[model samples]
Target chain A: MPSTAEPDALSAGAKRGRPGYDQDSVLNVAVQVFNKHGYDATSMGLLAENLGISKSAIYHHVPSKGDLLRLALDQALVPLEAISEHERARTGTAEERLEFFLRSTIRVLIERQPYVTLLLRLRGNTEIERTALERRRAVDRKVADLVVEAQREGTLREDIDPRTTTRLLFGTINSMVEWFRPDGPAGAQQVEDNAITMMLDGLHTRNL
Target chain B: MPSTAEPDALSAGAKRGRPGYDQDSVLNVAVQVFNKHGYDATSMGLLAENLGISKSAIYHHVPSKGDLLRLALDQALVPLEAISEHERARTGTAEERLEFFLRSTIRVLIERQPYVTLLLRLRGNTEIERTALERRRAVDRKVADLVVEAQREGTLREDIDPRTTTRLLFGTINSMVEWFRPDGPAGAQQVEDNAITMMLDGLHTRNL
Candidate 1:
């Protein structure tokens, strides 16, 4: 929960060598810890201690543990939000748009890796968790609509249901967080490209 | 918590006028109720009352609340255990084995629907939950080993990492318990066929 106010306290209150740690830097560390130990298991006190700051000092910018959750989910939400408005997604043939949307999503998830990972792990145990789940499903429904659009355009196989396909596709994408470690063997671009190719091959029309 | 001890008592304890009311039938009702209310949320008192039996009579069959969980997880674990030794799973080509594995997994999961659903939702808070999770992961790792084998054989896509692919595939398959109702629009066969087709198409050589 280290927010802007806590950083202000470092300079204004009693602290030495506080460095240039800002709200975002603190958030980065918090997300890493949250991903490592699940949200329920993580405590604000642990986060503050990790930041080498007092509990009160950590309360400057964010209000509570849930505030940090909202921020993390917001980060995860923006990329898919962008996808719906992207020109490639909006103006292209159904296959082209769908592929672009998917590839872009994978890329965003990789780049925002930990935040998206945290977002993916929410289980609706709290209000923030419930909201995150809802937002995720909203994104899912939008993607499903795109799939349905592809079906209507005769661009996807008629045999597969769009809703089921979309769930499988996103399920694959959402799972990136579980295994894709940035420090691991595969590079981000490599992961995104490989997933996109496998997905496209699975979903695209034979003629295409 | 019904154990082998009180089968006679459990059977004799059933209400009269229903010819088929036996311990198995009673256990079926217990499982459904347990699943709906959750293990911790349910009590023997509530269960016995639901069954129109005295608590002592209910205790004649099951030893404790945990016994039901054992039975439920036991039921779910059987199909998964069966798959590891499946003839086709062992002797076939990797792709063939994986396809059969996927199809069979879906069928088993559907057949053991309530039990597996309970297994899937376990939070790992108790010894039971942790054991179930460990076992589930062991089953998962077995599948992961097959993916690794498939990758080594050059049968599956080498572009996407096998572990990631396994998680994604299982995530999709597991999420079925969330929305898949037996009496819904799609029957079990329809779901199985579509799931396999989508998975295979996504998994197989694109040009094929």
Candidate 2:
């Protein structure tokens, strides 16, 4: 039942005898293993083996596998939720605000690719996964609302259904987890720019 | 050792105790189970239980679980590969050809959603999975080549990298597997039209 607190404080009070391990480090390794082997398939023993630490030592950091999943999911979800509430996203013209949301989302996905990948893949098999899905859906609804607003204001195209547009827009962004490499030839800035341009401007050459 | 031939003939010739099943029926159920439980985690025993038949009956239809996966993946990949080879996808301007590929792909996905879902989720853990992935990648490369051709022809906006554009383009279409229900309120034609408009026309209101 270790709580999320300062790494030093939590580690200093640890009684399980594993030194040099913090919750953050443990969570990072856990997310990697979960991504490598799916969440349900990964057991604490496998996680400990991968961490090169005893199961008890791992428990000293987090209580159960669910806690590790929650922490890992939050790594991706928190920043995403922030974008929806940000002043820029809230106050600008619906079009500008939606663009801000998209840009920020792409950045978060690029920076936290593994976490977001795990987040996107959740099939809601467990209570914890279902809760995570609820949070994810809430974020999606907020973005879709922006699309609706933009469409209402006539700044965005009105022909397409807002919900479908939102899904496709986010789908394009989420699919990056499948193949986008942070260290690859395409940089994050390039991806962000290209996504905004392609999404906001038609891919077809304009007469302008 | 049930070859995929006439379902009736295969079922009639089966020496196994169970008489009702065919390779196609078994494959349909196996794919459903595979989609429910992941490919690696699903055992022959589990598939048999879901099929309400004996393990031997299951084996009579397909030699092994890998065979089931191969068959299921083919259900999706074959038609997709066909689209690339289709005359409409080959003869038109690059933009027109790419549009045909996109529309055809959306149709295939909607028609064979369960198979496509399993195919898209493959992680290449087995030889069969790896081969399916290679084929999928080849199809992806062909689509990307279309994008490149469109760009070279100046029909598509050249500012974005063709590879990135291709990924984002197909990414939008492939993302449909996530939530696009063929049975839902939105018909396949509507989803197809929205996706094409969103990808090609941009979401912004046109000045003209």
Candidate 3:
């Protein structure tokens, strides 16, 4: 879609070429702008202005605003998909795997706060939003599957429905984006420890 | 502020009078429209159109869009504040009080789904939004205090921060707005039972 075919265009560098920015850096700038002004209010021109590049240069890296949203979603989703494949996630008791999933989720929220916030707030008004929501739901279902396995193994309670428990867990974890700040008193490590304690042990005293 | 100054104006039949709508009915329609088009995007004129009333007549019951938001927020908050004053919340042990709080919360969320949904989505963009958020935070702090008191009583784990536990509990409870459909399979009673069980007893088996 870009005039990548005119390979020499890079050396020519449009007369106003402030500086060269890579695609990843451009995408990061676009995501921030998108989050701040909101998706519908944002324009490629605003992104170009923020990145100190020509609109044509912004186009060179990403085709459209929707494409930037898709890229940001990948930033959030790829890490989650990786968690499902991790050795800890793949070869553990259901409870153990679920804990690992939650811990990984906290780290992702800290590491990708803006992108994850965007993902959580997306209203499903567009094609990109709907696709992102589907991905999020699929990830949630994987956690629900673990809840089922854990319950079936007699580790989790059979009284509560697996689907309900899964939603509760996801809600608790996803809410980290609302308040978790790495620079705040609680670090990611602290959040992970507290989340694991609350999820696996609950708030009730387990006094020995 | 409305020309309710023209009290006789009503008897005069509002020159262009249309079918009248009551305050509660108007609030309900406004909440749905606000949810659909977003609070900032929705105008009094649009609300008037939705309710099939004259713009001036719409102003008679509610002074402004801000007033509608405040009224809707009251619907969500008054019930919650009342929960804090309930006999159970006031007289029970900390854990019992906490349980009452959660149960009451589930009922309010179910009975006022649309209003609660709007409350959850509000972003604190205006004066009314900020006040609503403050009220919400106060309610959250009350739950945290109960967790602290319960932990001190040795009924809850002292290991996890009370604030963290409260946030997790609120997250799980508030998320009902996302998937709850009164007509759907899960009933309010079922949700309450499941929430209390998972939250109090946790997912693990007691091995009885």
Instruction: Give the top-scoring candidate (DockQ).
Output: 2
Task: Score candidate 3 by lDDT.
Answer: 0.79
- Give the alpha carbon lDDT tens digit for every residue of B11-72 in model 1: 54455433334656567767777776767777988887667667766566678778867877
Report chain A TM-scores, every model.
0.84, 0.90, 0.86
Model 3, residue B72: C-alpha shift (Å): 0.9
List the candidate 2 regions with Cα displacement exceeding 4 Å: A1-18, B1-19
Docking class of 1: acceptable
Q: What DockQ do you compute for every candidate structure?
A: 0.24, 0.65, 0.46
Model 2, residue B17: distance off in Å is 9.8
What count of clashes does model 3 give? 0
Query: Residue by residue across A1-208, what tens digits does model 1's lDDT show?
Result: 3342244445422344445466666677788778766788789888887777777766774789889888878888878688888788888777778888888898888889888988876778899899888988887887888888877887677777676677667766776766688887777877776666556554223313
Candidate 1 vs candidate 2: which has greater DockQ?
Answer: 2
Between the candidate structures 1 and 3, which one is better when assessed by TM-score?
3
DockQ, candidate 2, vs. native dimer: 0.65
State the C-alpha lDDT per candidate.
0.73, 0.85, 0.79
| lDDT by residue (tens digit), candidate 2, A1-208 | 1232224535643434555567777887788888888898899999888777789887787899999999999999999999977899879798899999999999999999889999998989999899989999998998899999998999998888888888899989999998898778888898888888788786888512
